[model samples]
Target: MEKQLIISVGREFGSGGHVIAEDLAGRFNLPLYDYNLLEHIAEEKDVAHEGLKKYDEKPKSKLFSRTVRGHSNSIQEHVAQMQFDYLRQMANEGKSFVVVGRCAEYILKGNPGLVTIFILGDKDCKVKRVMEKYGLSEREAQQMCKKEDWERKYYHNYFCPGQWGDSRNYDLSVNSSRLGLEKTADMLERFIRTKMQL
Candidate 1:
């Protein structure tokens, strides 16, 4: 029987990490949990889907401070816990899947047959991709990238309490800029297959 594997991907803004995850899932016929994970949690917890969407991969802002403190536990805390529990349940089921973001690497720590990957790209390449993907000007793309990456870093640190995107946090760190998109996905697929001895 093939070994069950869990692939968790952490990535920088506009780094093609989502594309890479999609490729891997397609190649390996694995289930993918990304934004859809938020939907699932929202439905299961009976929380507002919009609320989950707003806080998804975003750090808490001062604007929400009073709202968060109004409850016994903040919505962000509840959502985080739900995501962690849902991921743990999936892993415990011996499912082979690919999860993008939501701090899967930290949550799935010590799980057998888990491979954590962090993907990053050069600023120029990322900015170009963002400009093309979002139909934005170069300057606009740069600004968006900077702001989103900062938010991602802050969100990860706030939830996981560690250096976001630090090489030490993952099993592999791939420079999508160096390999480009297709090649980077191909490389990661090969690496995961090899690690799983498939």
Candidate 2:
């Protein structure tokens, strides 16, 4: 059987990342896993729904012994690995889905029929968008963007071992600030169809 196409998106804060993912799913009639990945993991692993949020897009910060024999991973590490494996297994079972964040691109890298995309925009555009969307002042929006970007960077670097939002890691990268969400989604639909020869 042919492998299904999986588009995993990595994005910066206030980049319309979730919106784009939802739009893509709508355009292509594919299932999307965004915040729902957390719900699924929470149920399958017997982890509390709220408990899983602590690990969502967040990295572990504890120190562990580097050379200890029979070393075990931290709770967060173990759960993350489980979640990663679950996503892979689900994808393999013929779910053509759009996955948002959570280092999903890295988790599915080099897998057959996988398309990794990173969505980004200028800092000013991101700040403005966040401000308009959340009814926050410019300064507040900028601060929020800065803090979220830091968290995402730390999470990606600690888990995936690379610079987040680097275009090289993705099959295609798009700037939603210029094209807007709808057009960005349209462009992605065309891009994926052409790439996958659909």
Judging by TM-score against the true structure, name the best candidate: 1
After superposition, which runs of candidate 1 have C-alpha atoms over 4 Å from their true positions?
Answer: 45-48, 66-73
* Clashes per model (N, Cα, C within 3 A): 0, 0
The digit string of per-residue lDDT tens for model 1 on 1-198 reads 278888999999999999999988888888899878988777887876875776677776655554534552455656667788999998898888999998999999988789999999999999999999999999999999999999989878877955899999999999999989999998888898788788
Q: Give the lDDT of residue 24 in candidate 2.
A: 82
State, as a TM-score between 0 and 1, how close model 1 is to the true structure. 0.90
Backbone steric clashes in candidate 2, count: 0
Candidate 2 deviant stretches above 4 angstroms:
1-3, 63-75
Q: Write the per-residue lDDT of candidate 2 for residues 1-198, one digit (tens) a residue.
A: 244888888888999988898888777777888767777877886877776667666656567513247555565666567678878888677677888887888887777778888999888889988999999999999999998888888878877866788888788888998888889888988998899887
- TM-score each candidate: 0.90, 0.88
